[model samples]
Each structure stands twice: as structure tokens, then as C-alpha cells.
Target: MKKFWLSLLSIIIPASAVTFEDNDTVVLLGNTVIERAQKYGYLETAINLSARKKKLKFRNLGWSGDTVFGHARSYFGPPKEGFDRLKSDLTELKPNVVIVCYGAVAAYDGQKGLPEFLAGYETLLSMIKSSASPREIVIVSPPPAESLGAPMPDMREHNKRLALYSKAVGKLAQKHKLQFADFFTTLGESKGLTDNGLHFTPEGYQTAAPKLVEALGLSLATGNQLQSEHARKLREATVAKNKLFFFRWRPANETYLRLFRKHEQGNNLKELPMFDPLIADAEKQIEALKKTTLSLK
Candidate 1:
């Protein structure tokens, strides 16, 4: 059974592109776009089903409002502290593949901020390479903002800036010889894709998931397959796993748990690692479901 899946993956994944091998751990890192994906699970589901890697592990390390500078991740400390935290998490996870998506919030700064954004992005990539040393890095251009009429505020100008940033991202990917996923261009101004011209709705993620798989040079899973019972089970397991990880990494009342105020609730710190086994168990469930789904097909 394992050999069958391996052979299928080899056939589906283009040799010229980055590939996912069995047991490869993939970490999704970025801003609101990446972070919110965990809630829908469509993107992860598509990747898993399309790649057909039974043991492929996924970790969502997305931080809402995050920048290449790690501002959202900084918590109560300096931006450097947030950046350090990102490095630390990557080092701990030691993923085989890292998919990075940014440029949304940074694009708001427009032309004046372009240079700084690019520089920060370069530094962030270097940090990932030095810290985690992943086998492959995939840079994803931020998805374009939608233009819902009336009360949604026009996003045409913002999308223009986004396109500029996306172009820069593509060039960076080419220069570094890395795989690039251009959501900005692929998902340009779709109706019902975004709720407020920015964040994706569930249906939007469903629409974008196949595009992501295509951009990564992998075969696309059919809508029927994605909606199947086994697939739904897999997605549920994926979401459950992501929630466990989120709590493990970003616990409630962190200032009291493991920071300066740790003296008060630090005793609970030992409970953090307990989620590791739970996450592993959830992955096992996902693996089993993948096999069951494939066998049915």
C-alpha cells in the first residue's frame, strides 16, 4: 500500500518542481492569510489529497497581522523578540518544507515600503534556512484583495500595489531558485472569494485550494473527492491537530505561563509538551483516513 502511494505521488508531482515525500513535515508560515487557513482546512486538505503522501505532516505557524519583521508574533516584546520566536519554532519543528506567504499587510505601505518589505523578506528567508534548513522553500505571493461593491470600500488601488509586491516576490523566487505560488495573479478579483475584500471565506478557500495545488505543480483533487466522507474526516483531524498545536505554541495568558510572570503559572508549563503526543495521534488518524480514501478510489 505504501509503495502504491509513493508511486502515485511520483507520477503526480512534476519532476521539475518541489515534491513531497512520505513523512515530510511541511510548515505554513505567514500572516492572516496563512493563519486563517487552519480554520477552513481546504488548502491543507487539497495538498494532502493531491500529494497522496500518507505520512505528510502539516503545521500551520501563521500569525495574523504578521509581517516579515514578525511584528504580530512579538507579543509584548520588541520585534526582534517575535522574530526570535519564529526562528525558535522553526528550529523546533524542523520541517522538510516551508511555505511562506506575506506581502498583504506590507503592501498597505505602498511604494515607500516596498524596499523595506523586500529586505525584511530576504532576512526572513535567510533565518528560515539557517534555523530549520528545510529541504525546500516555497514562496507564495499574497492573494489579491476582492472588490465587493458598496460599503466594502474600493480595493482597486490596493490590489495594484499588491500586484507590484507579488511581482517582487516572483522575482525573488526566481533569483533564489525556489518554487513560487502566485495567488495574486491566479486568484485575481474573484466574486465571493473574500468577505471584506481581504480575508477568504470558506468557499473562497475551496476555490483557491486547487489553484494552490496547481501552482505547486501537483495534480488537483476533484471536488467530489474533497467532499467525500473520508476527506471530511481527514480535514476535521487536520483542524483538530492545528488547534492543539496553536494552543501548545500560543497558550492563553502567556505572560503568566512562560514569560516574565511565569513564577505564577509556570507550573503549568510542563503541560505544554503534552500536546505533542496528541498532535501525533491526530496525524495518525489523518494518515489512516488518507489510505482508506485512496483505497476506495
Candidate 2:
């Protein structure tokens, strides 16, 4: 059991920036947008598919309605406690690369909260740097909300504010010498992308994933060969691997598992560690499928 645990922990390792090394552990941190990404799997798929030469690991730590100040992650405690939890989580992951995405929700407050938002953002960046010391940090600006016509407020004005926030994020990235991806500017018109003004439709994430990959100086294997049945299998395998990883890293019902309420139902927490082996199996399957897919060409 000891040896097994050690091997499982060895899953995450350092990687290169221009392209991923075989053992890279990439962690995605942000808000609802990032959380929702687990369902679409476009971003993770793009990364895995684009990384033809190596296998990479990904862990998404997105919390719905989370802020730069760690609002959503705080549970019943203060935001500071949530911030500390974020730090601890990153430290545990020991990621080689971290993609930080935030700002859309903060932008809702408009200009009134921009300064505080930026400050908190910077602090969050610093904390991440201090905790994980990742090899590369890529900051992604939040996507603009669309005008959904009804209960949703006009997103034209919201988008203007979002631009400002995105610009601020870009400036911070430059100042900190980190890589930057501008989802805000790149997403362009909302159109049919979002169901409401704030969140994305599955199609929206799929459409945006490639742009993000491009922005990060990565390239996808897009050709007639990729349209084949084997290619579809590879895509499915990628999604399965990512889903297993998501559960391995970010399990649900933490309030009764890892938090204050654990005293009541913590015994069931044994199930959590079971995800590690499952994730490993999925990753190995992905590798096997990738080899078969590529060999066919």
C-alpha cells in the first residue's frame, strides 16, 4: 500500500513551457467558467491532443462564483481562510504549470471594484507563486457575457467592463513575466455561445478552446486524418481521462468530507483515495489510444 501510494503521488511532475513534457501536471484555477469546463472537456482535450509528443496531467480547481479573494471557496469561514485553503491545495498539487482565470464576476461590480479586484488578483498570484512555484503561469482573462434578452442584464456594458478587467489582467501578466491568453478579446461576439449572458454553452467552450490553445503558442492536429473514427475515439479517451482526474483532484461533497462537517460522515472519505487508481488507468488508456491513433497515420 505504501509503494502504491508513492507511485500514485508520482503522477505529477515538471514540464516545459513551449510544449509539455511527458509528466507535466497542469492545474487550472478560477471560477464557474473553469468549473463548467469539466463538462465540455474542450480545453483539456485541446491540450492533450495538441501535445502530441508527451502525456500531460491536468487538475481543475475551479470553484463556482469564486473570486480573487476566494469568496466561494471559503465555505462558512472568512475569505482569508478560503485564500489559505487555496494556497494549501496548490502546495499539495505541486503543479508544474498553473492557468489562472478570473475577473468576469468581479467585473459585474463594474468600475467600483476594479481596484480591489486587481489587488486581490495580484495577491492571489503572489500566493500561488509562493506556494507552488510552478515552472510556468498562464493568466487567462475571463470571457465576456452576452446579451440574453430577458432576466439577464445588458451584456454590452458588462463586456466593456470585462475588457477593462481583461486589460488589467494582461498588464499584470506582462509585469509578472507570465504567459497570457486573452479570452475576453478573442471570444468576440457572444451570439449563440452562451445560454444566459454569463455562462457558456457546450458549443461555446468547444469554439473557444482552440483560440486559447493558439494564444498559448500551441498548435492542434487538425486535418482530414483527425476526422476519422480513430480520432473520435482519441477524443473520447481524452475526456474520460480528464473526468477521472477531475474527481481525483476535486471531489464533491467536501463539506462533509474534508471540511467542518467531516466529523459526521468522514468515514466515507475512504472512497476518495480510490479515484487515484481509476485516474491512472484512464491516463494509461489515453496513452495507448494515442499511440494507436497516431500509428494509423
Candidate 3:
């Protein structure tokens, strides 16, 4: 099994591609596209499998409806507060790599919002640099929106805006000397990738995972390998770990747990750290699963 796995790795991941070091923590920051990734675990699984020999940690800090301003993450506070939370999370996670995924939501405003989007993204990158001081930062362009025919309104015009945003993202990556994952160009218009014209379905994530791995300069896993029982187990373990981390960071009743209304359950804050051990346990499971070989048959 070990020999088989190594042989597969050699073919998929090139020696020149970027690779994670032992104990490296990678944080994913963005909006719905990123947040939804946690549910499927395809991206995380692919990355982990590619670096099976190393112990890597992944933290998904994605929020639905979030922007470069961190608006959706703000909760009851102002957008600035959301930005603060982002900094706080980065500080706490102390990631070695930070992957920033924005621009899709911002592209919604079209030409009218491009400037502000870029400005906000610049600020967001600066904040990540200062707060986390990660060794590497990756900027990911959102995948192109699909046109699912009649009822699902054509997204060609919107995709044009996304293309503009993707180009800007590439420029930013170059300016900052960071890595860029241009999904807009790489993934293109693949039918059935998304349920609607925008959001990815589970299969969509599966399809995009290798593209992400490739964009990051890592080895690409074949669909058959990714669908193997071994891979499924690893992905399931990743999803479990992510769930624990999510509840730890964003408790359902945060208003009572850590906010102004915390007087009622502030003491429960101690329970938050309790999730650390459980998350660690889940990660252990993932690590163990990573060593197992996928059954190509």
C-alpha cells in the first residue's frame, strides 16, 4: 500500500510544485465558495492526500455572504468588527499559509464596485500579513459562473465581470509576490458543476478540487482515486474536524456565550477550548487515513 501510494504521488505531484511542511497550518478565508468547501471536504482531502507524509492543518474561516470587508462575519457588529474578527482568527490560527478567496461576491456590483473591491482586498491582504505573518499567501479567483439555461438566467455578462475581477486578482498576486489560483480560466464553463448558476454542488467541488491542487502547484488526484473508500474516509474525517472547529469558533449561541449578552452564559466560554482535544482527535483520524492507499479498482 505504501509503495502504491508513493508511486501515485510521484506521478501527480511534481518535485518542483509547492508543498506543505510538517505541522503547517493552512487557513482558508473567503465567502460562500470557501465556507461550502468544508461541507464536501474534497479540496482539503486532496491537499492532505498530496502531502500525506506531512502533518498539515487546515482552518476554514469562510462565511456566507462575506466580502473583503468581512461584512457577513461581523455578526451583530459593524463591518469593521467583522474585519477585526478576521484578524483575531488569523492571529489565533497562526497559519503558515493563508488562502484568500474573495472577488466573486464583490463582482456582483460589476464595474461600479471594482475599485472598492480591489481596495478592500488590498486592505484584507495587508491585515492578513500583519496579523498572521504567514510564510505564504495565496489569492484565488472565483470559478466562472455557469449558464444553466432558461430558468437559471444566463451568467455570461456576470462572468465578464468575474473575468475582470480574476484579472485584477492575478495582478494583485503578482504585485504581492503571492501565488494565484485562476479558477475562472482553468475551470471555465463546466456544465453540472453548479446547482444554480453560481454555487457548487458536491460533485462540482469534487471537480474543482484537483484544479485547486494544480493551481497551488500540488499534485493532482484522479477522480477514481478521490472516490476511493480510503479517500472517502479521509474526507469524512476532515469534515468532522472542520465541524468541531466551526462550533468552537462560531458557537450557535454566541450572543450569550461571548457577546454583550454573555452575562447569562459567559462561563460556558471555558467549554470552547474543550473542542481543541476533540478537533485534535479528529485530525489524528485524518492523519491515519491519509496513510492508507486508495484502491484504484
Candidate 4:
């Protein structure tokens, strides 16, 4: 009995590798690479299915073409406003884990932008830390674009610069003692997975999901048909909840609701609070599913 107890203790608390705790709120932040994940639900599914001992909440805050400075998130305003919004979002979410994904698009600027890129990344980190102190921050390298046999018009050179950025991301992770995941090296040669050599096809996300979990030093449950079915259901609920949150946070018709041109359609603002209940209901369903055992068999 003593031996059994000791074994269980070691398994419960491993010395190395980052681990998520019960009820940890995880937020994924990045550009199109991360934004598109909402449609596929691959990564989110993997994380939820793998998290055996905990109930985790996830919020995806991905903006297509966004940079480290929150450029894409800024709607009819300066980058600083966008940055402020990012900070506000983080503050509101109060996530326990934040997965930072960037570098690929910024690499488009080439070697000349490396310094600025890193500086912006560092500033972003500062903002996250300030808002969500004592949180687990995982840095994920942008996956490399596929070449489809011959290098496609500067694609080779783009990948070369991307490698540099990936290296820098790894270094940053080490410096901060944060977790690091390299999609560039791991997701290499994504021939059919990508739609246009860059964005992932639905199948691509399915393939990359497990890799993301592994890169983070997490384990996946031995998924079975039953588990898979349940995962699908739970993921669908999660996606619904995320959508509600999105509307609440960044409404589509913000111009009239909260921005400069509000007088005309300001009454529509009443609809915003309606999402809260829907989001809450979806979350409840997710939590209920989490309580069930997700055994492979």
C-alpha cells in the first residue's frame, strides 16, 4: 500500500515539464494562423481530450493579420488603442494559461524587421504578465508554409527567415522559463494539409493538433470512438460559447454600438448582454462533459 501511494504521488507531480491545473482558463492569441483554428477545433479538442485530471476553459482571441502590437485588432483606431483593447481583453478573461503564437507574418518583413519584431513580442509579453501575473505562457512558433515540390516564389527564402524567427521564439521561451513549441520544424512538409501553402486545411488542423499537444509536453488520451464522439459534442459546445464571447467582446456592428457612429443604432447595444446567458449555458454544458470520464476504451 505504501509503495502504491508513493508511485501515485510521483505520477501526480512530475518534476519537469509544464502542466495545466484544474479549471485553468487558457487563451490562444495570434493572427490568422490562430484565428482559423476556431473553425477546425483540432487543437482545442486535443487539449480538452487530453486534460484528464482537470476541467479547462478556453477562449480564442485570434485576429487575422494581427501583429505583436495588436495591429489587426485595432478597429478604426491607432495601434495603441488596439494594444489597450488586447490588454483589456486579457484583463477581462483573466486566463491562467496564454499560448502566444506569432512570427510567421512578421517574418514577411524579412531580416530587417527581426529586431522590431522581437521588441514588439517582448512588449506583448510585458502586457500579458502585467495583466495575468503568475500565469503559464507558452510560445508557439509559426508553422512553415508548404512548398509543394519546387519552392514557390520566394517561399524558400521566406522559410529561411521563418526559421530565424522560430529560433528567437525558442530563446525567448528559455529566457523566461516558459514552455516553447516549434511548429515550424514539427509541421514541416505540410503538402496537402495547407490550402495555399500557408493556411491549414481542416485536415491540416486535425494533424497539427496532436503535435501541438506533444510539443507542449502534454499527453493525449488514448481516444476511442466513444471519446471521439463526446469530444466532438463538447468541442461544438465550446465553439458556440466562443462565438458568443466574441460578439460580446468584439461586436460586428461596433461602429454603432460603442464606437464613433453610435447614435443611430445605439439601441442595438441592448442585444450585447443577451450573449452572456448563451455563453454561460454553453459553458455549463462543457463543464458537465468534462466531469465524465474520457477513457479510451
Candidate 5:
């Protein structure tokens, strides 16, 4: 019985002792996109890269259906845990970079005009900035939502505000001289980086993590980069074959056709599935390619 208790303690001890290493706490704040990543995903890999240096830890504070600037912590409420932890979380981790993703919720029902939204957003940014003293921050543009399917009239209008809010965030990053991850521009190319219209899948994280990794200056060495370049082309060939399979199967490959259209931004580590099975299949192949490429080093 004593041996059993000691063994259990040994396992639980390390898990409990874990406090997300220093310098790279990588505080990710936003909506479900950030929240879902708590499970195994690319954000894990990105943190791993960041961790390779100064002991990285991922602190998730994503709240679903929150707005970028509507002061959600007050009215809309927060996750059971609350993003307010940013203050204490920062005090403890002193994150090297804070990546924020909170626009989708604010865009939802808030009748506030653009200026009001921006003001609310600015306050949030201020809170985040002040909390950490001098931690680096990255303003990630909220990915577009599938507002077309929502029943609420306001939900219909939310995406526009989210877009505008993203623009304002860009300005804030510039003003603060913080890192701006133009996830809007980079992710804007596809059907806005998601399949369910909102919420990321395994693939969405795959697409965004590398960009965030690069944004944080967590670049792999030149030797690794050179090897990655060669591996990338072989992966491209794999994608081309997947595209061929789609063309060969199903209704003139219309679904596959839509996949390319929706997943045009499929490169750059995107993991979201697209309009067709064929296209989605090709994406999976590409994903495998990325794993193999990254493994070379």
C-alpha cells in the first residue's frame, strides 16, 4: 500500500508541479479557437518550439462568443475561469508573448457602433498590456465567422464588426510596437480559416501555429530551413496526387473543386477541411507532408 501510494504520488507530483515553464508562457487569449487548442494540436507544437528555448508554457484564456471590444468580462460574462486571470497569470508567468483571439463574441449582439467597439477593445488591450508590465503581445485578427447561418439579426451583422475590430487591433499593435499577427490577412485568403464557420479543427491549428511561431521569431535554423524547402516540394507532389484522386472520383469533382476554392490558404500549416471531400483529402495529404518535412530536422 505504501509503495502504491508513493508511485501515485510520483506521477501526480510532476503533473502538479508543472507550471508552464518560464519566458515562454505564450498566453493565448481569445474565443473557442484558443480554447479548443488545450487538447493536443499544433498550438502544442508551436509552444514546443517556443519552449525549446526558455521553458514555454501555454496559458489559455479563450472565451467563446465574446466580442473583441464589448467588455465581455463585465456583461457577456467569461469562461468559468475568466480571462481576468491575465493579471495574475502574467504576474506569475510574465509571458514572452500574449496572443489574443476575442472578436467573434463581441461581434454577436452588441449594438455598439464601430467607435464604441474600438474603445472597448482598446480598454481590453490596455488591461492586457498593463497586467504584464513588459511582456510582448501579438494582436491576432479574429477569423471570420459563418454569420450567414445564424438566426439572430444581430448575429448577421456581427462579422462586420469583428472585421473592423481586427483593423483596430492592428492599429493598437503599431501604437504599442507589439507584434501584429495579421491572422486576418493571412487567414483571410481561405473561407476565413474554419469549416464549421467558427471553431477551429485540428487542421485550423495546423495552419495558424507555424505563422504564430514565425511571428514570435521562433525560427528554425538555416540548415533546418534548407532541408524543409526540399521536403516541401515532395509534399506538393503528394497534394497534386490527392487533387487528381478527387478529379477521378465523385460528381465531376465539384466538391473537390470547392475545396481548393475554400482551402486556397491550405498551405502555411492550415488544418481546416474545406467544401469537398476530395479537397479535404488532399489537405490531409498535405498535412502528412508537413509532419514529414518538419521531422527531417
Candidate 6:
């Protein structure tokens, strides 16, 4: 009985210390945008769907209601469960990329603004870059919220700040050479947002997912391995919505997005196998993606 108890302690202690370590993981961090209530960030469903649709392995690490600015309080130090979870994710998961969607939770706090947000966010990126498992970091701006809802004044002002906020996001990404995504701009106005006007509608996700893949440098056709493993988990989960036309791809024609579309529609995989050597080269990468999403509990 004593030995069994000792062995249990040995296992439990290390389990408590476990840190995420898969390199291909795409860690999604944020508040309600990524909570179970909202279905893993409004963008998660589609991105996860994209992972499965393209057969990419993927994992999710988002906590609902976590304001990025507030995460330190909610996630670590005195030890907010979410913060503890995030530390575990960073120490053990070791994802290839960590995409963060935050700010909305703090939008009403009246303290954080574009510059303050940028400075604080830069620190977070610097920490990740300096950490044991340096990763590809992606910054996502908060989506626009309903104008007349809870904390009514704050919500009304939120959309007005989108452009200003997006500029900061762009500048920060430029400074750090990271990818930037504006859920606000992407899902703004014409996208048919929810009644609340902030949370995206099912249609909103369909609109946002492909663009996220483009911004994150995932092959639309091939998929980014950053989100791997859970591809088959929700293959049949479909939500209905209207399709909205989007603005043209600006700046770089972006090979990742372009190549992805081709891969998505291609149907000659069997014939390609005839070029076994080339196929082997391509598959080495696909196999690598599989390893990224394999761990995350």
C-alpha cells in the first residue's frame, strides 16, 4: 500500500508539471472568443474544420473570457487556473505557432488602448521568442462587438476603435515579423455578425476561416500543421450561413494562399504517387504536421 501510494505521487507530481511540447501546434489564446461557450473563438470552428477538411492535425488551447491584458492575473502568478493552463501549454506543448485573439475582454476596462496594447503584446511575443520553444506568433485583433449591448458605451466605442487597433496590430506584426489578423475588419459590417453584433455568426466563421489560413501561412489546400491531429474530430459538424464576397488579396499575392486553393481542389493524388520520390518529399512534411497536434490535454 505504501509503495502504490508512492508511485501515484511520482506520477501525479510530474503530471502536474507537464508542459506542452509539440512543435507544429497552433495555440489559440484569448477570452470568450475562444471559450467553449462561443465554440473556441468564433474562428475556431472553421479553422478546425479547415484542418480536418485538409486532413491536417491540430489542437486548441483557448480559454473563454480571458482578456489578454488580464491573463497574467487569470492564468499565472497567484495562479489563475487559465494562466496555470497556459504555462503548462507553453512549457510542455511547445507549439510551432501561437495565435492570440484578445483585447475584447479588456476593451471595456478603459485602461488598455492601441499603443498600450501593442507594448504589452510585444512583451508577450518577446517572452515567447526568448522561451525554450521559440514559436511563430500570430496576433489577432479583437472582433467588433454589438454597438448597444452590455457595457453599452464601451461596446459602441469598440468598433470605432477597430481601425486604430488594427493599425497597431499591423505595426506590431511588422516590428516582430509576425502574422496579423483582424477579425474585426474581416467580420465587420457586411459579414452579418450575430445579434450582439460582436460575436460572429456561423456565416461569419465561414468567411473568416479561409482568410485566417491565408494570414497564418497555412496552405488552404495543404493546411498548416500548426493545427494538426484534430482534423477528423469534427468533419461532420456544419453550420449554415450566407456567403459574402471579400476584398482582393492585397500586397503580396501570397504563395501560401494561392498554393492552398490549388491543393484544395486537386484530385490527382493517386497519379502523383507515381513520382514516388517527389511524393516522398511532400509526405515528409505532412508527417511533420501530424506530430504538432498530437498532444494537448
Compare the candidates by TM-score and give the number of the best one: 1
Off by over 4 Å in 3: 1-16, 221-223, 294-297
Off by over 4 Å in 1: 1-15
Tens-place lDDT per residue, model 4, 111-176, is: 899999989999999999998773689888888877655544436878898888887877777777
> TM-scores of all models?
0.92, 0.85, 0.91, 0.88, 0.54, 0.55
**Each candidate structure's count of clashing pairs:** 0, 0, 1, 0, 10, 22
lDDT of 3 by residue, 1-297 (tens): 999987534333323455578999999888999999999999888877777578899999999989999878888877789889889999989999888889888898988998899899889999999999998888888889999999889999999999899878877777777777776776877778999989999999999888777767777445467878888888988998999999998999999988999999889889999999999999888888887743233
lDDT of 5: 0.52
CA lDDT, every prediction?
0.86, 0.78, 0.84, 0.79, 0.52, 0.48
Q: Rank the candidates by lDDT, best first.
A: 1, 3, 4, 2, 5, 6
The TM-score measured for candidate 1 stands at: 0.92
Model 2: what TM-score?
0.85
User: How much lDDT does candidate 3 score?
Assistant: 0.84
**Could you tell me which 10 consecutive residues in candidate 1 have the lowest summed lDDT?**
8-17
Provide the lowest-lDDT 10-residue window in model 3: 8-17
User: Which residue pairs of candidate 4 clash?
Assistant: none
- The C-alpha RMSD in Å for every predicted model, in order, reads 6.9, 10.2, 7.0, 6.8, 18.7, 20.4
Could you tell me the lDDT of residue 135 within candidate 2?
87
Model 2 lDDT at residue 149: 83
After the best TM-score superposition of candidate 5, give how far the Cα of residue 82 lies from its true spot, in angstroms.
4.9
Off by over 4 Å in 4: 1-16, 149-154, 223-227, 290-293
Instruction: Give the best candidate by lDDT.
Output: 1
| Better candidate number, 1 or 3, judged by lDDT | 1
